[model samples]
Target: MANVTKLRCNETVRIEQARIVALYAQLGQQAAERLMASAIEDLAMHMVAIDAAVQKNQLGAFDDAVTSLIPLARQVGMTKLEQVTRDLRDCMRAQDLVASRAVLARLMRIGDRSLSEVWDLEDMSI
Candidate 1:
């Protein structure tokens, strides 16, 4: 989370490429890009909340930050970040491991939502 905040636009774009690779493995390149866009859109909603919290210097704003970031993380195959955010939230509430695991499981659900699967690894035998 802090790492994301530290990254510049170009760095973010590079990380974005990693996400593209993840989505492409399950769907195809085009579908993966589209999914990335959609995920970005979803994350934007939570970003709004995060921005608000950061402006106020309030630790309580972490909820909004996590909420905003997870959708984007899930979209980009960043299951770990999504899990960490979920873990923090659940622990903050009542220290529930089951809930955290469930949240992680939901992150994996993105693969199931893919429309198709294709790969351009055919002509690479050379």
Candidate 2:
């Protein structure tokens, strides 16, 4: 069961490149580019909110941050970020502060990596 959970987590952490490609195909290059930029901004804002929530040990704020992150992360093909945010939300729901803290750290790392991956894709003209 643990292995299965790990496998699922690994899968969620990866960006769905096909989704991004399909967005570009459907929206056209300029519109897709703008949407990506907006999504990145939203992600950054939410990250800041999450960081603040964690620092203050405010679960409500953390929950709010995660809530805002899910759809935006999905829209941007940030599957890992979306998944980790969900994990954090669940930890909060369970009132597991220790687990929530650990998940928060993981979220920061994955969020950074996912954003960089998207930037790299953009650089490659993907």
Candidate 3:
């Protein structure tokens, strides 16, 4: 009998709470909420593009999509998500499909959780 060990990758998602608070303070609650929602939507839309590129084996498209996502993530202080995003970009740039697959999975996980973390703050008083 052969043994198969599954890899469960649960990464820690670090949200810069102070950055978010500063945003709310600078822009006020109403404006910050709107911007946050829009940014989240933008992130989700680009993540879809990245997934589609990965599925279709289009490295150039994947790289471009990931490149665009980097700044948006940093702006919101999603430290872990941004770091993973950069890692994925490096993988794609190296033309390393094997590494890209694993990195892509991590990026997606961090991305989704980061979005939720920001979205959840929409109603909370920072």
Candidate 4:
């Protein structure tokens, strides 16, 4: 019998504080909060779409959902999430399923954490 160890991927995510601050300044706190909530909701939905698409081997759907996510992530300052999204997209472009799958899993982890942090920080200065 062999001992099996589980690995956890806790990727470091970078959020752009200045960017978020500017958003609050430009839109006013209420409007910015509304917008941020909407964007976060959309990002979560897209992650679900991407996961389902990947499971079904529907790359086109995955592309559509992921492409939409990059700008949304950038809008609210999820820079690391944006970069990981691109990395996964690049892997897909190269037609390397192995790497693409690996990156996809990483993307989901980063995306989940980034969204949560953003939502949690909505009430305070980041």
Best candidate per TM-score, number? Answer: 4
Kindly list the per-residue Cα lDDT of model 4 for residues 1-126, writing each as its tens digit: 999999978777768988889999999988998999999999999988987877677889989998999999999999998998899888877888888889889989999999888977886863
Alpha carbon deviation, residue 68, candidate 1 (Å): 4.0
TM-scores of the models, in the given order?
A: 0.39, 0.84, 0.90, 0.92
Best lDDT among the predictions, by candidate number: 4
lDDT of 1 by residue, 1-126 (tens): 355456322111113345556567779867766665676556545545544543444447756677668776666655644554566466545645566445434433322222111122212221
Candidate 1: stretches off by over 4 Å? 1-13, 16-18, 56-62, 77-126
State the lDDT of candidate 3 residue by residue for 30-121, as single tens digits.
Answer: 88878788888888998989988977889889878887888888878888888888888788778888998888898899999988888776
Candidate RMSDs in order: 11.7, 5.8, 1.5, 1.4
Backbone clashes under 3 angstroms, per model:
1, 1, 0, 0
Candidate 2 contains a number of clashing pairs equal to 1
lDDT of 3 at 56: 82
Q: Which ten residues in a row have the lowest lDDT in candidate 3?
A: 117-126
Where is model 3 more than 4 Å wrong at Cα? none
Q: Which stretches of candidate 2 lie over 4 Å from their true place?
A: 1-13
* Model 4 TM-score on a 0 to 1 scale: 0.92
